[model samples]
Target: MNSIDKLRIVFMGTPEFAVASLDALVGAGYHVVGVVTAPDKPAGRGMKLQQSAVKKYALEKELHILQPERLKNPQFLEELQALKADLQVVVAFRMLPEVVWNMPPLGTINVHGSLLPQYRGAAPINWAVINGEKETGVTTFKLKHEIDTGNILLQERIPIGENETAGEVHDKMKDVGANLLVKTVNALANRTIEEIPQSAASIEEVTFIKHAPKIFTETCRIDWNKKVSEVHNLIRGLSPYPSAFTTLDGKTMKIFSSEKEIAVPTSEPGAYETDRKTYLKFACPDGYIYVKELQLEGKKRMGVDDFLRGYKFN
Candidate 1:
């Protein structure tokens, strides 16, 4: 048998993003021993329990699954050890303890959303888009003592369209990351890959490195006084979830899609200029952010035209 076929792999992930990587490993004929995913939690208006995307995929494959309430729990650790995994593949899973990640013989590998030593935190993709980056990609690296400060195994770069939202980038990244994981695994199995430290990924001893931190409510609020490009980037970066919002007629209006016009605004920032039929544009300090799609408080999301057709100004 081949070296890749002989080693036992444990796959750990929770969300849809991780499912892509797990599926790629299986499709490439890896001997994944067991799957570890988050416990099912109640969701939706009905509050019925919902299985994570990873768990659903595992069930379909009949793979042994582990859903521990806590990673450091004695029983979970014992069960993980029982799998006899040589390597662990982690995607969108929670942070792992040393006892868990350090247990496997070959060590744990993680698929991070951004290139290492760059956006190394919880919300990499969102931050990249918010910052108006032209290029960003995924990194597969070994799990070490620190979070994403691991040695890099493989990385693949992708371009970000001028107006692409975080959700759009996310869809593209999942597939790209999945393919890279398979390549990383095969190279490791063949002993052909040379891992690099995150520090070496860059040349200059720069003062600041970008970090991806969790987004909060304040981060999602729209500041109409910023430059047009900066404000547009913020809107795209947070689109389709926790959207960028501004107050309109004393109601919160969350914008999902917009186009920026670089024109000196006649009205004050955050003021609206609309024809009551075709367009709704909010003024910024230096330009206008024309809304294409949005959701108002207590109303369903719709095109700006559709929303304007029925709504009245206060």
Candidate 2:
């Protein structure tokens, strides 16, 4: 047997974004002993129990699965300890207590969505795009007491395309992160990795680091008073999830994709102009945000032309 085959691994994650890493490890001939994911919960109009994407993939792989309602449950802990995992890998999972994260001999490692010392939080991809950053990447780090504050194991940086939505960036990062996680695991098994402290960089160097807190309903409300570029970024950053919104005709309108018009606007910020056939746009402080994709309340997502075809502004 290969040396890597002797190192038992346990994976913890809950979403589609994490399936890539778990799949990569199994494909690479790693001995992933078990998987822990969120419990199936009711979803959709019919309220059927929906399994998490990671759990679905794990079930297909025939891997041992655990879905504990509470992380601190004694039964779950007993089962986890029974796995005898040499190391643990986490991606898109909830916070772990010390007993769990510290149980593995080689320690638990996390594949985070952003580079260290910046964009540290639950919604890194959304925040990076919303803040108009030119670049962001993935980081694999050892788990510690503080969230996302651990010794760095490996990282791979990627450029964020202009006008790209957070959903787009998320899709790209998942693959990159999967490859990097495999590399990190191989290096760890070979004892070739050197852990570096985040504080190794001076405070002056990382002063611009930003936090990526969880986005809320209030957070997605569009602020037309801002510059067109800023408003555009906000819309794309939240696209397809907690999407940026505004009220039109006293009903909510969700904006998905938009183009910016930088010419000085004739109308006040928050004011909208529509030709009732071709375009629907809102003015900002500096210019206009020409919304190409949007959804009106009680309607399906459609292009501006299609939206205009069915309804006329009073």
For residues 1-314, could you state the per-residue lDDT of candidate 1 as single tens digits? 33878878999999999999999999999999999999999999999999999999999999999999999999999999999998899999999999999998779999999977889899999999999999899999999999999899999998999999999999999999999999999988888999998877545632357899989999999998898999999999998887899989999989999999999899999899999999999899899999999999999999998998999887
For this target, which candidate reaches the highest TM-score against the unseen true structure?
Answer: 2
Best by lDDT: 2
Candidate 1 Cα outliers beyond 4 Å, as residue runs: 201-206
Clashing pairs in 1: none
- For candidate 2, the TM-score is 0.98
Give the per-residue Cα lDDT of candidate 1 at 8: 87
Candidate 2 Cα misplacement greater than 4 A, ranges: none
- TM-score between model 1 and native: 0.97
Clashing pairs in 2: none
Q: Weakest 10 consecutive residues, lDDT, candidate 1?
A: 200-209
Clashes found in each candidate (C-alpha, N, C closer than 3 A): 0, 0
lDDT tens digits, residues 192-299, model 2? 999999989787868877899999999999989999999999999999898999999899999999999998899999999998999988999899999999999999
